[model samples]
Target chain A: MGIGPVAAQLEALLFVAAEPLPLPRLSAAVGLPERQVRTALVELAAHLEAGGHGIALSEIAGGFQLLTRPEHAAVVAALQAPRSAPLSKAALETLAIVAFRQPVTRATIEELRGVQSEGALATLVDRGLVAEAGRADSPGRPFLYATTRQFLEHCGLRSLEELASLANLPPAVTQVQPLPGWRTPARGAAGPEAATPDA
Target chain B: MGSDDRGGGVPEKGACQAPEPGLESVWSGLDAGTLAPDDVRVEALVGQQREVAADLEDATAAVVQLSRVLEAKARALLPTPVAPEAEGGEPGAEPDADDADLAERVAAYQAFAEAAALLRSYEESRALRFGRPQPESKTRRPAPSPAGAVSLEDLLTALSQVWERARPRTRDVTRERLTVGQVVARLRTRLSRLGSIEFEELFPSDADRFEVVVTFLAVLELVRLGEARAQQPHPFQALRLAWSGPEAESR
Candidate 1:
């Protein structure tokens, strides 16, 4: 079918594309100039908003994509009740560090989490979420890790940029966490329940 | 340790003198001729026994030290235990919890990570795009290769495999005559009759890099205009190219 409007053409491309569409690529795909495409994208975002559509345009990672509004997270979650369990707390934290501060080394991640994370790092690697982006310039040439495209897809993010403006989630718990001492905090009454799954 | 003062030989069995109670087993351990040394002097024997005892004590101490080190290492490898109040605590001050159950912490952290990934997955899947649907899982069952059964990755990989193989020079030889345009025409004709052809089978066994490159570019042209499509049943498997439709006549 012929592209009716420039904005509609852009939406059609983003809708079918597996990843976010950047300006140049969108321009090439739609046979329009980059400047014109950029303006059309803005108009498209406003168009979706003004029309009160369920989906809206967002700038994430380094491209433009269409995603549902945040207000519909609950309904969407219900529709897609978690298929698998969440990753370990360590994996999640490691993922957060990799997502935000990518091209980082194990040493940097360890420093951020305040704990040795060989196992956690290994788990993330095995799961295909974290990957060795490259070797660091420092001594011994330690491997630097970064989140993979699979990670972006897994997190439901169009791009890393989309992850930036999230409001509800607390900052990744990077501060070196205090470990439970031998002296029970006089508060493990539910310790069995909470620690069982973890155990 | 000192040189023997008396004869170092043992007396005949019947003529032997009384020995210390604990030394009875030690004496019997020596063979009749195997006593190789004399037991006539007790002081030297006592020194030897003391040396053996000290060696045993040293070995036991080493083992204890090694076990302690291993325990410390095992503790260090475990996940950080939950200390909710310590969320924003000191930066580098890591606690040494003597009773930390590392396995438990790892398990807890694992659960937490799984939860995060699940939530993240849900969040991203929002406003699901309607496009080409993913291949059905039931299709994962074994099936013979058929038309329209090939995946996009397999098709691209086959093309890439040809492209990558063409990059490395097999030998020092230079003879270039074909052009991308000529090869494109030849490729279109070769694939014209056969609905599809396996990537490698299309070429002669002796086809060199140059010929392959020319042929590859032609294939790219044909596929670009939807005149032809490639198929691959599995990644890196044989690649096949087929005409897009009956209406595809040579341009």
Candidate 2:
């Protein structure tokens, strides 16, 4: 199909898609050339703007999706009851370690926490609180975790520095002397179940 | 009577010559009248000289003793580590000059190393306080684009791109259109209900009053097209938007 029809078809596809669809997947689903799909998305985005419903089609995180205008947040919140939950202790700890020790492996997290955190990590991923930022440059090249924007939102932070200040938390264990100079991780430390103080 | 006797005693022939003119004259001219008793004066001067000499000797001895005492005290009070080179040498053997110098250099280096380590740790701690790691450079390089050069359009575009990239997906299958008015209405409703929203999505652009205008229009358009939806699942929670479906009408 030409750019016009391809753009129209892609827009149609995004309009019905449940989730933000990756460009490759969208291209495959529409059975159109990738370049054409990209051009169509741009054109369709402009067309959407021209129509003036305030919504726009755009690509995010390597995917194409439709989103509401930002100014409408309060309206949406009123219509849909907020379902967000405060971060769990384990999630907080995991986020901290990831922020301060970014490009760190899961094994390192286990070492710091002194326990297996496979389940907690999964929960964080499901919540979009953390993501596989990249692979470590070690022997195994293990997947490394990092806090996502969602994590920042949960903490009510504008940047990592804001979160870092929050980390001056009391140590998980009371009796142990908190490392005199250790700053809390950028995301704050976890509780005893997920964190341990140095002996 | 004494004068003639004393004269006769000096020498019999000389005494008899009656005091020759020159000799008599010289003796008569002498200042014996003003002189103290010669014997007593001599004895007193001699005694004084001896006393001075004795005092000098005592002072010198005391000075020497004081110097010795000071040297001993200094040796005792100053820390004296065994010289590394000297420890292996015999009592009479002179230590190697090179070894002594090396030991001094090593000690100096060790002191320097300790000072450097302390400085590094101090810097690290300071960095932690400000929510930063130790800076690799003392000053940061300036950004490529000067802050003054950034226009409102640039900022809005950046913000828009970020929102486009970072927003999450919705689980529902029904598409919704969002317009600027709809979005504003949604936010106003949510705010009146005391609900919060993702702060980023709430103010996604840097365009002053225009952002509010544009985004409101955009959201209403979105609602009309059925590409997105406003959500408030709870009273205390903030309003949020989610992708409803892909069947949203084309704008």
Candidate 3:
């Protein structure tokens, strides 16, 4: 219905932010508690929607940003605003694997694709769709890659859970099954499964 | 629902359909001593195999479908191309190159000069972009100063020294690395419990070479501070430590 002063201040911040601002960051910036900031963000989103504003409040990449509505995307593009290039087929496939089986190593991705995906992996990382989650405890301690929050924004997903549900896979298929001679997905941090060396 | 491609695209006339073996026909065959029990068993096994194959195919198709959906979503989310800027000047206001005004002539000259400079910059930028990735290979060193500012050998030597100094040092930041204080605490805990422990027993089970070194240092500090005594009966043997600190005396 109506936005408060907190919501208005949040709107200005979101509008100017190049990247999404997380709740904690927003709270710190506004000098308010996170709970109050969250409430204001909700009110701001509602106000934008009700007012039929060209820019809408979007929770993307684990943060809030003011993004042009989908309907106005065409008009905004017509104004010569910068937009990221579309990913190649190979890059998309690599992204999908990273999204589905996160904290995965490059060797696993190559094994699944049956081809070297270095270029695609690099491109995904360059585009901010994927990032190094951590290193596996196995031999060589290869860096594990996972989809970033930007990945969720790109796919219009709220969370990794949303991406998982989108597949509508059977419950059994959802569980991480360790391949032969491969360590389980959980690495380090006293994980339940024992580490298996590469065969 | 009844008639679709689920029949594997067979015609509705059923001309290609296989003959069905009715239960009566089967009984007649049995009475006539024509059909064997093994044949029926074989038929059942074949059907089971077909069902299993279908299930496998379904699972495969589901996975393929999921991949396709993810790819489609990714494609849909791609940012739209921004429209190109329209060139200035009205369509009807065409300038004749043969009889141009002074203003147009100077403008044309300036434009030509600008284009040349822009082209050179574009080439230089392209070269830099391509060359950026090649330095990691270390196959080719930076080309000597074109103006012969210094000998190639001297330049290479100096640059190598600078590079060594400027290169960022990386360290393993995993939680596995132990601090000196942590090793000291662990030693104190075990010593207080057992009154005395061998040097080998001071190290934790997950101790790495670094941790082993730290643990040794901690024990040396305890002895140096007159808080513990190290007794080795023979050379190259485990050193036994007895706590004699203020905490131990109070206990």
Better of 1 and 3 by DockQ: 1
Chain B TM-score (each prediction, in order): 0.28, 0.20, 0.30
On a 0 to 1 DockQ scale, where is model 2? Answer: 0.01
TM-score of each: 0.37, 0.28, 0.40
DockQ for model 3 equals 0.01
| lDDT (0 to 1) per candidate | 0.55, 0.46, 0.55
lDDT of 3 by residue, B144-194 (tens): 221122435676899999998996989987676577778787787778777
Worst 10 residues of 1 chain B by lDDT: B138-147
Each prediction's number of clashing residue pairs: 18, 64, 0
Off by over 4 Å in 1: A1-4, A70-85, A114-116, A126-128, A149-199, B1-251
How many angstroms is residue A196 displaced in model 3 relative to the true structure, after the best TM-score fit? 32
DockQ of each: 0.04, 0.01, 0.01
- List the candidates ranked by TM-score, beginning with the highest: 3, 1, 2
For A22-71, candidate 1 gives per-residue lDDT tens digits of: 57678889898878888888788888888878877876434577766778
**Candidate 3 CAPRI level:** incorrect
Task: Provide chain B's TM-score, model 2.
Answer: 0.20
Candidate 3 chain B least-lDDT 10 residues: B125-134
